[model samples]
Target chain A: MTLKAQHVSWRRGGTLVVDGVTLQPAPGSTVGLLGPNGSGKSSLLRLLQGIAKPDSGTITLDDTDLALLRRREVAQTVASVTQHADTDVDIVVRDVVRLGRTPHRSPFGGELARDERIISEALEHVGLTAKADRLWHTLSGGERQRAHIARALAQEPRELLLDEPTNHLDIRHQLELLELVAALPVTAIVALHDLNLAAMFCDTVVVLQHGRVITAGPPAEVLTPELIADVYGVRAHVTRDDYTGRPTVTFQPGPPKGEVLRPLQASTSVRSA
Target chain B: MVVGEQGRALNALTLPVAADSPSRRERQWSRYGAASVLTLGGLIVLAVSVGVAVTLGPADVSLVNVRDILLNHLGLAEIPVRVSEDAIVWQERLPRALVAAACGAGLGLCGAILQSLLRNPLADPFVLGVSSGASTGAVAVGMLGLGGSSLGLSGGAFLGALVAFGLVLLLARFASSGTSGVILAGVASTQLFSALTSLIMFAFADSDEARGVMFWLLGSLEGMRWNDVGLSTAVVGVGAIVCIASARSLDAFAFGEDVAASLGIPVARTRVLLLILTALLTATLVSIAGAVGFVGLVLPHAARLLFGQRHARVIPATIVLGAVFMVWVDAASRVAFAPTPLPVGVGTALVGVPVFVLLLLRRKGRA
Candidate 1:
C-alpha cells in the first residue's frame, strides 16, 4: 500500500529532468504534486510508476524494490493515467478499459467474466458507460481523458497515478473528477496545476521547483501566499475559507510587477476569505 | 460518514449496470459470431474458387470431368477421364491453384502483422523491401547462372530477404523517427535492390532468360508443382497458427509501445519477434510466387473493415479472403488473356487499386 522513492534522479539529453527527489505517500492517502511546467512532476510520476528507471535511486511499492519486479508485477499493483495516451487505430472505450485487465489475464485466455465486470464498473465510475461503444476518435478531449482514467481504474490497483488528468476538462467535469478521485478507496498521486483543487482534495501536497522538492506538508500547512509568490512569482491572495478551513490560492488581478518575493518561508500574512 | 453514502451510491448505481451487461455481452459475442461466420463464408468461397480455378485454363476440360478428376484423386468417387485431361487438371492446374491460395494467405497474414506491429495502417511486408530483395536474389541466381536450379534461386532469394530485413533494422535503429525511419530505410533498400535486379536483367541475361525473369518478377504460377503446393501449405499453415497465437500481442501494439508495455507486453521483444516472423513469412511467399503484389497490403485492411479492428477476427478473415481473392485473380489472369499469360501481379494491382480506393472512400464516407 505504501509507495515511495528515495533520492531519485533522471537526466534527459543534457538536462536533469528529475534531480535528487524522494517521495513517500502514506497508505490510502491522496498526494497532490504541485509544480510549474518543467518542474519534474511528470518525470517523478514516471519514475515512481516503474516505467522509467531513475539514474541513481530506488523505488519501492509496499516495501518491495520496484526495479526487482517484472513489468507485469508492477502493473498489477500500480496503474497510471498519463496525459498523452492516444491510439492511431480505431478502438471502442470498453476495449480500452478491458486492456487494464492485462496483468490479471492468462496468456491464452479470452476476456474473462470478471474482467468484463471490472471494465463495466470502471466505465460506470467514470460515467462513460453510455459511450462505451463509440469509436475512440469520436470522443471529445475531456472524454478521452476520462476514458483513460477509467482504463486505469479498471486495473483495480493498490496505487493510482495520474499526471494532469484534468487538462482538457471543463470546469464542472474538473470538479467532478477531483471529487471522484478523492472518494476512491485507494492510494493516489496526482499531478495538478490547480492549487485550490489540490487544497480541497489532497490529504498531502508536495511542491516542486526546478526539478527539486521545495516544500511538502498537509495542504493547509504548506499552501501560503509566500510559497505562491516565491514559486509561481504571481501575486496571489491567500486565505482560509469560512466553511472548509482549507487554504485557497486565488491569483490577485494585478500586474506581475505589483508583488515582491518574501524573504522568509513562514512570514506571509493571510486574510480569511 | 459523508464518504459512506457515496460508496453506497456507487454500488447501488452499478446494480442497474448488471441489468445492462448481459445484453451488451450478447451483442459483443454476436458481433464476434458474425465475424466468424464471415470467415467461414470466405473459406467456402475459397474452396469453390479452387475447384473452379482448376477447371479454368487453355485446356478444354469439362466441369463434370474436372469434378470427377478431383473426386477420384480424393478417393471419394471414381469416373474415367483421359490421362491427358487428368494430368492437366491434377498435375498442372490443381497445384498451381493451391499454391496461389497459400501464397495469398501467407502474404495477407504478414501484411496484417506488419501493420499492427508498426502501428501504421499503410505498412506491409513489401514496404520493408523484402520483395525487392528477393527479386534481386532470384534474378542473380536464376538469370545470371549463379545458381542453376529453382531450389538455389529460392535459397538465394531468402538470404537476400534476410539481408534487407537486417539492413532496415540497423538503419531504423540509427534514425530518430523510429517507425517512419524504418519505412524510409525500407524505401532506400528497396530502391537499391530493385536497381541491382534491373542491372542484371539488362546487362547479363539474354532475351529468353530475361523473359523468364520478367515472368517471375511479375508473379506467374505457371510451373507450380505439387512440391511448391506442399511447401507453401506447410509454411502458410504454420505461419497462420503462429499469427493466431500472437494475436493478443498484436492487439496490445495498437496503442504504441508505452501503453503496450504497461499492458504487460514485452514491447521490444514482441516487436522483434513479430517483425522477424512477418519478414520470414513474406520472404517465403516471395520465393514461391515472385512477390505477388497488393494481396498482402490490401486484403488485411479489407478484412479489418469487414470483421472489425480486432486481430483475432481479422487474421482468420484475412487468410480466407486473401486465398479467395488470389484464386479468382489468378483464374481471371489465366482465362481472360487466353494464350497470352497475364502476369498475376499486374492483374492483382489492376483490380486491387480500384477496389482498395473504393474501400478507402467508403471508410471515410462511413466515418
Candidate 2:
C-alpha cells in the first residue's frame, strides 16, 4: 500500500503554513522530507499523519481516502512519532512501549500475551530490551529517544512517519538510527535537517521551501549545489562518494548567499560615507 | 507487514522528556507480583477499616458487635443486638463510616484523574472551585433561608458547585496554558465565591446562625443515611470505571498534548469529559458533606507510593486507600473530642499533614 498526497494546502492563523504540497512516496521506501526551519515540513508531516486536515487536497493511503478513516484506523495503519516524548509521572520503559497497543485493544481489554510479545520484540528492535524495566525518568537522553522509537515500533503500523529523528543524537547514534530506518521494510517519511545524512540514508528525498516542494528525486539527482543554494540559501560543493556512490555535500564557509565576482579597477572609487 | 513501520516513526516520538536521570532504586519486585499483593492488601485494609471504624465513635460499641452488625446487614450472619444499640450501629455510625468510605473513594479517584489529566501532581477533587462554590451555595441557604429550608443547604450548595464548575470551564476556554490555566481560573473563581459567601453571612447571619452555617462549610459526615452511602458509592464506582477505561490514554498524556494526539487519542474530548466527571464527583460529595479537604489531595499521592504510577494500579489503589483513610479520619473526628466533635474535614486536614510529609519523604528517599 502506498501513501500519496495531492496538492495539499493548509492555513493556520492567517498564514498558509503548508501550501499546495504533494507527497508521493514509493511503497516500502524511505523518503526524506528535507527543509530549512519553517518551510512547512513539520506541518506537512502533521497533515500526512492526519493530525491536521488540508484545506483543499486529498491524502490517500493504499488508494483509500485518508479522511474517511477513523482515528484508530489511521493509527493502526500509520504511526506518527512527533518531536517530543515525555510523561509527567514515573513509569517503566516496557509499560510505555506497551501503550502502542492502545488502538489495537479496547479500554476494558486485558493485556494479551500477543501484546507483551510485540512489546518485547519492539524493545528488541530498538535495542532497548536490556532497559525494558527502567523507569521513564531514569533513561538517558538517547535512551529516552530510543525508548520512544521502541514505543512506536510496538505500534506495528504499516507506514511510520517521523519528524527529525536524529535531532538529539550524537554522530554515532545518528548514523546507527538512520541505518536502522534505512534497513527497515516499511514505507517511511522522515523529516530531516541534515542534508548529508538524508543523502546517505534515504532512498528518495523531497526538498521543501516556503511550504512548497522545491525539488524531489533520488539523492544523486536531488543533492546538487544549485538545489542546496536555492532551497537552503547556502552555497555548497557536492561530490559523489567513490564506494557508496551517494552524493557528499560540503557547505562553503562564507556568506550563505553566493559570492559573485565583479569587475573592479585598482583605484579606490568607492562611495565615501 | 505492519512490523516494518518502526522506521516510519523514527522522529515521531516528540521531545525527549530526557531520561538523563539515572535509575534511583531498582524496582524490588515484579510488577505483576507487586500489583497483586498491593491489591489484596488494599482491599483487605479497606474491609478491616470499615469493620473497626464504626466501633470507635462516641456511643459504646465493641468491635465484635460492630462486625456482627455489618455481617448481619450483609446477610452473612445473624448476631442479634438490642434495638437502640442496633439503631446506633446500623442507623448512625455504620452509614457515617460507609459514607466516609464512599466520599474518600470518590475524592481519591477524582484526585488521581485530575493529577494525571492536568499533569499536575497537586491537583485534587476541588481544584476546579467546586468546594468553594458549594460552600457559597450552602452558606447562602443557611444565612438567607433561601428555598424556605425544603431544598435545604445541600441543594443550594450543589447548584452553586455546578455554577462554579461552569465558570471554571468558561475561564479554562480562554486560558492558553491548558491545565495550569484551568487551575488559575479555579483559584480566581474560588476566591470570588468565598467572598460572596462571606458577604451573605455578614448581611444575614447572627453569631449562632453563622456558627451553624460554618459547620456545613467546613464539612461533616454526622448525619449521612443509607441512601447517602449508596449514592456516593455509585458515584465513585462510575468515576473509577471511567478513569480505568482511560488509563492507557492518560499514559499518553504523561508526555504532553502532542504525544497524546499522535497516539490517536481525542485529547480535547477526553480532557473536557474528565474535567466534567471530576467536577460532578466533587459536587455530589460536597453537597452531602460540605468540602472535606486533603483526602482528595493527599490520598492519591499516598496510593501512588504504595502502588506505582501506572493508572491500572493507581486507580484501584487510590479508591481503596481513600476509603480506608476517610473512615478512620471520620471516626477520629467523632471520637477524638468525645462530646464535642469536630468536622471530618478538619480531622482530615489535621491528619493529612503528617501523612503527606511522610509520602514526600519516602518519594525523596526513593529518588
Candidate 2 lDDT over B1-367, as tens digits, reads 2334544444333213322222211222344457678778888998888778877766788888877777888899888877777899899888888899999999989998999888888888888999999988887777777777787888999999999999999998888566788989989989999999989989888899888878877889878899998888888889888898898778778777666776777778899999999999999999988898898888988888877877888888888888999999999888888888798889999998898898889889988
Score candidate 2 by DockQ.
0.27
Please provide, for model 2 over A1-273, each residue's C-alpha lDDT reduced to its tens digit, 9 standing for 90 to 100.
677899999998799988899888987799999988888989998899887889999999888888787777777778877887666677889988887877777775555555666787778767789999888888888888887877777787778898898877788888877777776666889999999999999999998876878789999999988777666666799999998999999998653453343322211122111
lDDT of 1 by residue, A1-273 (tens): 578999999998789998899898887788999978888999999898887889988999878888888888888878888877788778989888888887776655555455677888888878899999999999999999999888888777778899998899999889888888777767899999999999999999999876889899999999987778667767787789899988888898553344454433322232111
Q: Distance from true position, residue B226, model 2, in Å?
A: 1.6
Give the distance in Å from residue A119's predicted Cα in candidate 1 to where it truly belongs. 2.4
Superposed on all Cα atoms, the candidates' RMSDs to the truth, in angstroms, are: 4.6, 7.1
In model 1, chain B matches the true chain B with a TM-score of 0.89
Chain B global fold similarity (TM-score) for predicted model 2 against the true chain B: 0.88
Which portions of model 2 miss their true places by more than 4 Å?
A256-273, B1-41, B71-80, B176-178
Candidate 2 chain B: worst 10 consecutive residues by lDDT? B19-28
DockQ of each: 0.34, 0.27
